[model samples]
Target: MGAALHLAHAGQPAPGERHRTKGKGGSGGETFADFARQVYGDQRATPLARELLLAFGYATMVAHSEAERDVHDVWSTARKAMGATRTGRRWRLDEAIADDAPRYVSSKDREHRVCEAPRLRPHPDGPDDFRNVRGICGSLADWEHYALEKQLGTGWYKYHWFCKRHLDHLARVREQLREPNERAPQPVPNRGGLLPAYFESDWLGTYRHRLDSPTWEPPVYGISADDWPTPGVEPVAPRARLRLAALDGTLLVEADRGARR
Candidate 1:
């Protein structure tokens, strides 16, 4: 747990220091470090929420490791910055992209909206091509038929999207299928030595193995082959390597390089 070990004391600002910044007062002015601290302290946030936020905070820290200011596109930035390391850029292929959420909320079709313009599909041969993968507009699918998967488990997700009426019926059916004595697992906070296990076992473990291998092909949605660091070719940055070390279970190293206060 290199830098995430003692996150509470590492280069943190004083009690009143965070509020002095010029921006939206309170949380809006807060840095990723400040936001992480608040999430850790908030008793109301669920364990799942805490885990998500902390992981995001760690990703943010790694993304802007060379910069002092926070970035707006933390996810995209992190994907690019960590592309060369053993972490690879793909987070989770099964998780539904939040950017695609708004379309599902509207009663009317959003396909014709000025903002929802048609985009080119990835090249058939590969994402990387001499044409830069640019192509003609494939027929846009209708907004009404657009569906997204609901993740159920590892390598598993709902096969089809359901309407509200069908979802209500399915909810009842699912409840009936559960045993009377069955109980859901209680969620635990990913802190006080628990985070390292969860991070290593689930979060980083997902893509770390693929990145460590040599024969990996660049996925259309993930980092390109050019971004992959070749052995003895391009040296991996210290920040890129720090994320993997931070989640090590047996290590007790000092956490010096952390997000700015």
Candidate 2:
């Protein structure tokens, strides 16, 4: 879906240049986009970050102009996975029977038979295979974690939490879909489900009460459904607020700075 489509549903005022919040006070800083990269690890986060800034009545920040070495190392991974194999005087990548898992071993060896494209050639190591690839995504170590978890996490059986997180990651990634990544269109939106939307607002309100009354701040912004306390689950004060200020287009920024410590 294009931003235009999203904007339609968002018939809310396009904040644009009209509601500029003040620059960060008392905290020395970077530009909004740069700060977004610092905290979220991506400079492209600038636009979304700008949205977040305005929600709270804060101005955009100044950020580093140069891309820092990405926190995740990607190069070493590329070399390992891309190396080809030789069989009967012909060389090809291994048949990696791919699926969407960070680890590729599902009993569901269902490769893309749609056009039979994957089966025709040896499987090149996927970009997610950080064990060898590099840059902008997946460090070698992150890929290695996938590989290691494949071996150790119940013989590559994924955790329920893994599936949940995968769904959220998939959504955010889809929101960023202008560029392609290893992620594919999901069969379904299997993340914690729409159930969280109901409690998310209320839970956050109480969480903020805990923060500010002592005075207020969130333990963390944007609580995942999994992290919520259940009925009779006592609420604990959150550590700090998340950057975004509102939901349903009514949220306002009441705090600043990315981290307290």
Write the residue-wise lDDT of candidate 1 on 85-200 in tens digits.
24644443112111111111212334331112123456465656422333322333333332323222211112222233244533554455354213422111111222222222
| Tens-digit lDDT track of model 2 for 1-261 | 001000000111132312122253423232333333333432222343323222211121222111121111211122133334454331111111111001122432223111111122223586454323322222111211221112221223231111222344434434443243223321211122111221122334433332333233222312332233323433333222222233222222222222111
Off by over 4 Å in 1: 1-34, 59-62, 65-73, 76-90, 93-261
Q: lDDT of each model, Cα atoms only?
A: 0.32, 0.24
Cα RMSD of all models vs. native, in order, equals: 20.2, 22.7
Per lDDT, the best of the predicted structures is: 1
* C-alpha TM-score for every candidate: 0.19, 0.21
Please give the lDDT score at residue 28 for candidate 1.
26
Q: How far is candidate 1 from the true structure (C-alpha RMSD, Å)?
A: 20.2
After the best TM-score superposition of candidate 1, give how far the Cα of residue 91 lies from its true spot, in angstroms: 2.9
Q: Residue 180: error of model 2 in Å?
A: 31
